[model samples]
Every structure is written in C-alpha cells, then in structure tokens.
Target: MRLDGARVLVAGATGVLGGALTAELAGRGARPALAGRDPARLARAAEAHPGAPTAVFDAYDPASCARAVHDAAAALGGLDAVVTAFGTVAFGRAAEVGDEVAEHLSAVNALAPAAFLRAALTVMGPGSVIAAFTGVVAEHPQAGMADYSASKAALSAWLRAVRREARGSGIRVLEARPGHLETGFADRPVAGTAPPLPPGGDPRRVVAALADAMEADAELLRTAPDGTPVVERRAR
Candidate 1:
C-alpha cells in the first residue's frame, strides 16, 4: 500500500476533502485517476498532476459508479487503491426530515460507496486497498444531522462486513472516521440549513493521516477535532 507510484482512483475528486486527497496522493508520487460528477472540476483536479486521468459519474447511480471504476482502472492500467470520498450531508431533526432528503442522503452516503467498492473489486487484485472516508458522525450520532448520521452508519456497517469477508483475499479495507475538518463540508448541506458550528480541523493534516494509514495498511484511522492523530487500528 505504498503511496509511491500506487495506481489509485479517487471518487468525489472535486469535493474539498477529495481535492485535498487527490493533491496529496499526487504529491506522494501516486498516479491518481480523479472521478466526480462534474467533468470540468475533474479535469481541473487532474491538471494539478499532469497525465492524471479523469472520469465522470454520478455517485448515486450504480451503473455510473461501475463505469467510472472501470474507466479509472483502464486509465491506470490497474488499480492499487480506490478511495471513496463521495458524500452529501443533510441537516434536520429526525422527525421533520422529509423522505426525499433521507433517501438522497442514503443513496449518496451509503449506497453509492457500496456500488463503487463492488465495481472496484472486480478490477482490483490482492494487495490492493479500498478506503472510505466516513466521518465520526457515523459512529456517534449528531443532533440536526440524523439522516446524514444514519447514512454514514449504514456505510460503516457495510465496510465492517466487507472487511471481514475480504480478510482471506489479501485486499485491505479501511474506514476513516475523522472529526470535522475546515473543508466547508458542513456549510454545503444537501437538505436543511446548517447551524452555527465551530471551525473544523486542518484539511491537510487529515489527508496526511489517511495517507499514512494507507501506507501502514491500517484498518481504521481516526483523528481528533483538531486534526491530531487519535488512533490507528490494524486488522486483527
């Protein structure tokens, strides 16, 4: 799982966290294929690292997810790592949240990543890694973000099961539960308005932590609110 010269595909490359990750991966000497819904943004992200490939796909669409993975793998010749940073947050009280918002959140946060991973495994081989950036809200629910929390929780559960199932295959699965980062993610809620909240951790620090975990083949990497390293769990 060495970042140097690793063939990686990063979904949601246009988003704040994903952008940081893509840049960091490039800086670490990894060949990254940037994928996202916006072709323009994906192109821009790829421009940061000359010769990097770009793929366009809607995260909520299973077919698109599969196609994106296939295209990225083809572009890279083979994939050593696939990182899913695609996510949307919805803020609302559980009781007042509409069904549409809940469904959208689930589709983007849970179902989309599942689809991407499934497709990625088809092309990925042993020694490859699949990492998902699921925030701390997945493990600890937060008020006003019930739907968002539930969606991430579902993804976390799926990742745990997949990790157990993939144990014998030599393919690593990592789940990162980083605390809030100053990526402006909270301000871009897909549904309800965001309430006032404290500034988050440094995005660069969070990306570096994830890169370190991938290099060490860790199972879980958790960071504190201030981007301080908290814990790195290895597969037992």
Candidate 2:
C-alpha cells in the first residue's frame, strides 16, 4: 500500500527494529504514532518525529494494549496500519527454560499481539493492516531456544486465526518471520534468566519485508534472508 497520507501506529517504538521502522514510516510520509512501555523513551523518540502521537503501553497488559490502540487511532485521526515488533527472546535449552522466562515470552509474543489486534480491529474498518515480527525459529525450531520459538510459533498461529476472523473487515493481518536479526535483541538483560544471543541477523531486510508485505496486503507467512517462502497458511 502507498504509505503517503497513512496513519500508522508502531508498537515497541524504543527497540532497535522499532526505531528503524518508525523512521522508515515517517520517511515515507506516513504519520507514525509510537506506543511503548517507557514514557521517557517514547518522549525522546516522539521528539524526533515532531507532533507525532505517543502512548504508554505494555504487551502483556490487555487493558493497556487496548487503550494504546484506541488512543493512537484517535490521536492520528484514524489507524491505517499497525506494526508490532514487541516481545522478548530468551535463548535457553528446552530443558533449561524457566517458568519466569517462559511466561514473559508467551505473554509478550503471543497474548499481547492477539489482544492488540482485537483493539486495532475495533477502531479500524477496511483497508487497514496489522503486521508483527516473528522469527524463523518458529518454523525451523532450534535446540537452544524453546520459549522463544514457542512464543513466535504462537504468534504465527494467532495471526492466521486473525486473518480468518477479520476476513470481511477489510483489515489484513500479516506475520513477518525473519531469520537471525542482527539487532542485539537477545543480548539484553532479563531478571531471573540468562541466555546468549542467537546468531546475528539483518534488520534492514527484515524491516523492508515488513513495509512491503503490510503495504501490499500479504498473507500470514515468514520471510527469510534468502527470499519469501511459500508457507501453507492461506490468505483471503
């Protein structure tokens, strides 16, 4: 879809990928509203994109997610697109994965996206889209990543379900599963857990895929550095 004159809401605006996505959306002439967990970081990013809307939101909190979606839609006049790069990844062996780590990944990666999509659809009607970031681990599972892989797999499945439910609503749902993001996502610190970073991956190609698929109304599928794969899930 042509980004000009579009009103987009970007969740996880503070992260490396989210930061790049936000800048790309703004550069394309779309008004981007940032929704993040930290007000300070949101304010800093918002200042860079003057007059753009920003909201305090959490991926695990359904109420906060709903409020952020509605508030962003209202602030930007209407929500044309929503992109989520939120969630965490912990790289521990399946046998070593802890309850806290598993819960965090599940809540942020799976539950949050489902809840956010619900709120986004409530405000947006036709000609809108929802794109989220997933990882190739969902399909080609790894030995050292149980919680992370499962979370992304849940997201991919959930997006397929969303596409089915929103068939007549004119709202397209897409899941972007990129491999080995170079972004230091897994390098971050997490309380009560420790896991090394997965193989480094590219962020530009991933963001480009996200922009193109969401803009052009693609199906629920994953993207690789090599090219777009033919996933079995259907798109209406």
Candidate 3:
C-alpha cells in the first residue's frame, strides 16, 4: 500500500478531482500515468509532468480501456495502483432525461469503471490496489439527479460485488464516494446533460482522504463538507 515509487494509472486525469489526485500521487513517489478522452488535455498534463506516461482512452470502449491499462503498465514497467475516476452527472428527472443521454451517463459513470476494474484485475497481479470514485448521491437520492444517482449507485453495487470476489486474490478493491466538491464540475459542459457542482467543495481533502485510505489499505466512505457518507457498505 505504500505509494513510494508505486506505479499508478489515473483515468479521467483532466477532471477536477482526478487532477488533484494525480498531483497527490506524484507527490507520494508514485509514477502516475494520465488517461483521458481529450488528447490536448492529456498532452498538457503530460507536458506539465515530464516523464509521465499519457494514454488516450474513451471509457465507453472496453478495448480502449484494456489497451490503456496495458500500455500504462508497460510504460511504468509495472502497475501497482489503478484509479478509475471517470465520471458524468446528468441532472434531470429520470423520465425527463433522454434515453441516449441516460445511457451515455450510465456508461460513463458506472459501466466504464466496472469494465476498467475487470480489465485491471485480469492483468494486475497481487499487491495491486484498485480505487474507483463513486458519488454521495448513490446513497442519498436527489430529485434532479435521478439518472446520476442511479448510475453511481450501480457503480457502488458493482464495486461491492467485486470486492467480495477479489478478497482472496490479495488485490485490494476500494470505493471512494466523495460528496460535493469545489472543483467547478457544476460549471463545465457535460454533453448538454447535467450541470457541474457548485463551488467551495474541497478537492484536496477528498484526494487526501483517498490517498490515505489507499496507503493504509483501508476501505473508506469519503464524504463532503458535512462529514456524511453519501455512500456506505451495503448490508448483507
């Protein structure tokens, strides 16, 4: 679990939380490979962190996801930790949201990470840590966030099942559910779907907690400002 010189891959590297997390991982002596859908943004991040590997990946494409993981592991010589941080929130009533948008959001939010984790575990040996970020809304439903919440909830469910399967493999599976963060996600364009989050959410704290949990090999329920877990361990 020690991050010192650990080889790590962070998906959604251009995203608000992902950006902060990449920095934190690098600071901890982990060689972080950046992956995103945007070539320009990926190039920028790579330029900012010279010697770091970059991979172009679309979360919806399982082939691309597998390839990226393979290449990143190769580039870094080996992979120790893989962080699946790709996310999308489409704000609206579930019925009001179009089918296409709903499917896309679901794919990005839930299916993407699920597929990524599967691919990662296939190639990743023991002592590898896999971290995926879910949302607080997965636990507490919101009227305008029905689709978003369901997608995150599905992701949480998927992680829990995988955790049980991977328990004996010595491969750690972690789920981090962070609440409203100040990272301007509320302002960006998410394919004309949900709006970004409001300001004042601390990205640093979320990333810090995630880092600590990963290093300590602890399963966590990361929260927002109020210290409430939007996500928790599901009851048997």
Cα error, residue 110 of model 1, in Å, equals 0.6
Q: State the local distance difference test value for candidate 3.
A: 0.80
Clashes of 2: 5
Residue 91 in candidate 1, Cα distance off native in Å:
1.0
Ranking of candidates on TM-score, top first: 1, 3, 2
User: Against the true structure, whose TM-score is highest?
Assistant: 1
Q: What residue pairs are clashing in model 3?
A: 91-194, 181-201, 182-201, 185-196, 185-197, 186-196, 186-197
Model 2 residue runs over 4 Å out of place are 189-199, 225-236
- What is the overall TM-score of model 2 with all chains considered together? 0.89
For model 1 the TM-score comes to 0.96
The lDDT leader among the candidates is 1
Using TM-score as the yardstick, the better of models 2 and 3 is 3
Candidate 1 lDDT over residue span 136-213, tens digit each: 898899999988999999999998999998989899999988888888888888878888877778888888888888
lDDT per residue as tens, model 2, 1-236: 57888999998889988988888888878899998999998898788799998998877679999898999998988899888878787765677777988899899888887777788888887988888888787787777777788888898888877788889888888777777666777666353244454455567656765676666777654544554443324442
Q: Show the lowest summed lDDT stretch of 10 residues, model 3.
A: 227-236
Better of 1 and 3 by lDDT: 1
